[model samples]
Target: MSVMIILIIVSLFVASGFLVAFIWAVKSGQFDDASTPSYRMLWDDATTQKKINKQSSNHKQKSNGN
Candidate 1:
């Protein structure tokens, strides 16, 4: 059908747009630190963990008062 032809053209345009955006991101160093993010989660500093625990406990106490 004629509609199928138009749909295929539109889909191709959309796919090409995504490809261009991905290429731009690569050139812009958006993915340069690829491995650091994966390792970041494993390096949990103790001070930040203590602060998070303190905040959560405070939040729980405040919520319980309601």
Candidate 2:
């Protein structure tokens, strides 16, 4: 019974620490550029088929010892 109380207190303290850290991160601008990541993900054009084809050709040359 007493161990349960100690466990609850420790759990609450750990949870509070996490909450404080998250709040500190928010205040420190960690989540400032929310839209940038989303837009960057969508705007990235480097994944086009042309680039992949070139990479594949390079790998093929390496495999052929050329």
Candidate 3:
């Protein structure tokens, strides 16, 4: 039937849209770090905090000198 043909065409278009979206996501690095993010929460941030504190202290010393 004509209705069936139309439905098939619409379904194909929808499927193709999803495929294109998936391809675009892959090409744009959407899945580049699948493993890192899962373990990111377990990583220690103490070093980062130390660096930030040191920078702030240096800034304060400069301001006091000026």
- Which number leads on lDDT? 1
Q: What is the lDDT, from 0 to 100, of the residue 35 in candidate 1?
A: 92
Question: For candidate 2, what is the lDDT?
Answer: 0.90
lDDT digits (tens) for residues 1-66 of candidate 1: 999999999999999999999999999999999899887776666667988999999999999999
Could you give the candidate ranking by TM-score, starting with the highest?
1, 2, 3
Task: Report the alpha-carbon TM-score of model 3 versus the true structure.
Answer: 0.58
When summed lDDT is taken over every stretch of 10 residues in candidate 1, the lowest stretch is 39-48
Q: State each model's CA lDDT, in order.
A: 0.93, 0.90, 0.91
> What is candidate 2's TM-score against the reference?
0.61
TM match of model 1 to true structure: 0.65
- When superposed on Cα atoms, how far off is each prediction in RMSD? 6.6, 5.0, 4.4
